[model samples]
Each structure stands twice: as C-alpha cells, then as structure tokens.
Target chain A: MSRQASRLDAKKVNSEFLTLTYGALVTQMLRDFENAEDVNKQLERIGYNMGMRLIEDFLARTSAPRCLEMRETADRIQQAFRIYLNIQPTISNWSPASDEFSLVFDSNPLTEFVELPPDLTNLRYSAILSGCIRGALEMVQLEVQCWFVQDQLKGDNVTELRVKFVRRLEEVIPAGED
Target chain B: MSTYYFVIVGQNDNPIYEKEFSTVNKELRKEDHRHLTQFIAHAALDLVDEHKWKTANMQLKSIDRFNQWFVSAFITASQIRFIIVHDNKNDEGIKNFFNEMYDTYIKNSMNAFYRINTPIKSPMFEKKSEIFGRKYLLS
Candidate 1:
C-alpha cells in the first residue's frame, strides 16, 4: 500500500495560513497552560482526538486492509503520512522482537520555522504527531507507546519517533457465553 | 414514516450521546419518548455485542427488532458505536447517516476539552447532528 500512488489529489493550502494558525495555537496553549508539560499534554490530547477521527478518513480513502503485524502497521503509517503530509520518514532500528520501531524524518513541515525558546527547550514541538500515531494505532487495537527520541529543533539532524508495542488488545465480547 | 432514535455508545458501554427525531414529513411528537427510545437503544447494545465478533465489518445493520423499531449500528475502530433505531428500513440511508454522524463525532472529539466516555455537551455537535438527522434520516 505504501508503494501505490495516492488516489486522492493533494489539496493545496496556503503554507502561511497553516504556519500562522499552528503557531498561534501553540502560543495560546502555552499562555493558557502556563506549564510546558501541560501544554504538551494538551497538544497530545488534541492530536489523539484528531487521530481518532483521521483513521476513519484514512480507511475510507485508502481502503487499506487491516495490518496483521507491527511492521505492516509501520508501513501503513508511513504511507498515510506520505499521502497526507507529503513527508516520508525512514523506518529504522527495528527490535529483534519486532515490537518496536523508529521513524526518522529528515524534514518536518510542522516545525518548518518553529524555533523553541530557551526557556521551553523541553517542549516537543512535534509531539502531537506522536500522540496521533498512538491514538490511531490504539483504535486498531495495537496498544503502543509513541515518543520522540530525537527532534530537529533540539539540534538533531533528524527528527525521530520511537513506537513500542505494549500489547495487542483482544476484543472483549460482552456476551460471549450463550 | 416513523420516529428515529440515535444513540452513541462509548467503548465502556456507556451512553455518550443520544437524540430522537421523527420523519420530517410527520408531525413531531410532544410526548416524553426519550426514556422509551433510550431503553430500546440500550437493549440493542447487548445484541450488538453478541454480533460484533461474528463479523469483521463495522456496520451491523438491522441487528434487532422490537415491535416496529429496527436497529442499525456502525462501530468505529475505536469502539465508539453509533446505533440508530427507526420503523422504516432504508439500509443505504441509514449508512450515510451514520457516516455523517461519524464525521461530526470526529470533529467533536478533536476539541481539546472533550474527553472519551463523557456525554457530548457541545452545542455545535448537537446542531450538526440535528441537521444530519433532518437531511438524511428524517427526510
């Protein structure tokens, strides 16, 4: 699915609009939350909510089949990000157990001109993406932990996120016994 | 033409949101039918659970029938279940209604203040849902 060309044409939007709106949102969140951690949590929560909805759009658009393995899930995410965001991240550092993997993004549009202030250096500017991936995967019953291990804003050449599969959820049948 | 009851069930089997509307052509009822509609919708949940594992698809169409009422369901991958009960059976229209409702639910979920399993109190959500019901299910 990752190799196939996207059927939907990319909708063009003014980059300025995106940058300005996102920047304002972040600024307002920082102001309202006061604490950087709280801002991060808020951002993640927003992303999680968005992800819960986005997966539907993705499935409806792509009609991609369910992923049976973690590796396939990684590919699906890569394809989804590429098609939607137009940024392809390198999937690497797969654990022997195949329960964890890292996505290294050479360029992240979300952080194009985002420069974290020295006081808020701890802020993960793109943490929302991690939260989105986590929330979307969780909906598919793949319980996983997603976090940014390396961020370009933090002076790293590549922004990387590590996803660790916690466990697979068995569908709890409410009335299994006849 | 018949009355329609919509219910959204959370992953924990809690009622997250619900609404009742009759066909646009029919006169709206003044009687307090909320409790009865809720009861029928709640009873259908048990049937939804029993049938959920039987099929991989999300749309559990016409799962149960009580008198003239028929239940149709659409379960999101996140386990948020959108169920609709009505007298007339129009499978395609019900599917479209659920799809639109899913979109609205997603938009509601995107709100930073909103949390899972909580009743949706957003006026915007309520308004959109009403519009969808009128446009698709009612008409």
Candidate 2:
C-alpha cells in the first residue's frame, strides 16, 4: 500500500507542479510582452500547440488502446479532462439559436478555492482550456470554434463554456484517387 | 577548449535546446545574432550524442567543453531532456542558472499553450533568459 500511496503522491506532485509552472510562465510572459492582448494570444497559441502534442502523450501514458472515431475522441477528451484536471464538463444543448454547444462545468478546479490576484481578476487563465479543445478537435480534423460563453468567476449567473462547430476541418485521407 | 555548443536531444534526437557561447567568460554583444553563437553549438551537440550512449544520467560537470564551456544534462524521469551550456566561470552560479531555466522551461512545457520540443525562442523565453543571465551570470 505504501507503494501505491507513493505513486499517488508523485502524481499529485506532478500535476500541481505543472499547474504552478504554467501559471507562472503565463504571468511572466504577459509581463515581458507588456500587453494583455498578446498574452491571451500566446495563451491560445500555446494551448493549441500543447494540445496537439499532449494528445500523443496522453494516449501513450493511458495506454487505453485507441479512439475509433471523432465521437470517441471527444469522449476521451472529456474523460481526460475529468480525471486529470478534476473538472467535470457536461455536453448539452447545441442549437441554431445558440449556434454552439456547451460544456457546463459545475465546478472549475483551477479556480476552485482560489481567488485571482487583484490585477489578474480580469484575465482569464482558463482560455488555454478552450485552445486545447480546439486543437484536439482539429487533430481528428474536426473543425470547431470554441470560446468561453460564461465564466462563473466573471459574475455570469451560470458558469458555462460554449464551443461552436464552425465547419469540418480538412481531413487527411490516405493517398488514393478514390 | 575553444568554445562549446550544447543542446537537449530527446530519445528521437530532436533538438530541445541549442545554445552557443565562448569559453572566454565574457558576454558577447547583445547585437551579436544567434547564428555566431549557434555555430559553435554544433560542436557541443556532437559531444552530447557521444555521452548519452555511455551514461544513464549526468551531474553538474559530467560533460565539459574545453575550459570555456561546460555542458550539464538532465533527463526527467519521464525522459524529457534538459541541457544547460554555460561558461565554467562559476559552477554554483551556473547551477542556479539551470535551476531557473528549468523552472521556466518546465512551466512553459506544462502550459496547455505550448507544444513539446518547441524551441524556447519565444518572447517570454528571451525576457526570462535575459533576466536569469543578468541575475546569475552578470551579477
């Protein structure tokens, strides 16, 4: 049991380490560039690139076999987000009136028990989460536009995020005339 | 001896790092483009390839480039590699530099925003690198 406990501790350490480090990096980058807009752009760019690469690592580490289709891929993303980040997002609604689907996180772990620094209250750290979703969707060649429709922290009555599937991204098919 | 270039290569031999510097322990002009520095970095990389085959892990001075440059390598338990190449002017100072660099690198890597194995040439990197170099190396 000691071994199992040790492993759990290690995993927790690693997760916290990643979170702290990423936060510091973003904070420092924003300061260096001296631009909040640029910082957000970097955050998204970084998230997309990271998501593309992390999908491979996540697959390798989990060794859960594979996802057979885009739907499965999306499911896998939801599962990973739940287990790794402790945020449970539910998929719902997606209609012409909304023009986008929603991933409702009843509780946001990154922001849980946490208050944003005074200057950063307006800055959204979870933007990276949106980027990751977009990149992961793109990897399976599913074209989508994702954004935070609502953030509980920002005085929205409902804490929710909506992702819109704009159009199907290019699919890399096998080489064939067919 | 003359100079050293050091880089971090993963299991796939992709360059996670590339830094060139004179062993002379004097700062090059800030205007000096990365090319001149990266030129000698070629040699340091050659040394890394040779060393990886022999050692499972490296310490503070496992690999030294002449009297001018010293290469320090670290491979995370996950097999992510980190390489630090700086002048041997001060080992303690160099160690501290690597620590800060590692902190920044790890954070950047963990960021959902960044891709793995990407060059650390972002504006953030430049800003942090300058701050770190000034604090540890210049002071």
Best-fitting candidate, measured by TM-score? 1
DockQ score for model 1: 0.01
As a whole number from 0 to 100, the lDDT of residue B29 in candidate 2 is: 41
TM-scores for all candidates: the values are 0.52, 0.45
Tens digit of lDDT per residue, candidate 2, span B1-139? 2333345565565676655534344565444434643444445555656666676653434454544545565555555555655554456666676678777776566544445666654455657766776676556
User: Can you give the lDDT of residue B100 in candidate 1?
Assistant: 90
Model 2 lDDT, residue A53, Cα: 75
lDDT of 1 by residue, A91-172 (tens): 9999999999999999987776565656788787777898899888878888889999999878899999999999998888
Instruction: Look at candidate 2 and give me any clashing residue pairs.
Output: A46-B113, A46-B114, A47-B112, A47-B113, A143-A169, B1-B66, B5-B41, B23-B68
> In terms of DockQ, which candidate is strongest?
2
Q: How much native contact recovery, as a fraction, does model 1 achieve?
A: 0.00
Proportion of native contacts present in model 2? 0.05
lDDT of 1 at B83: 91
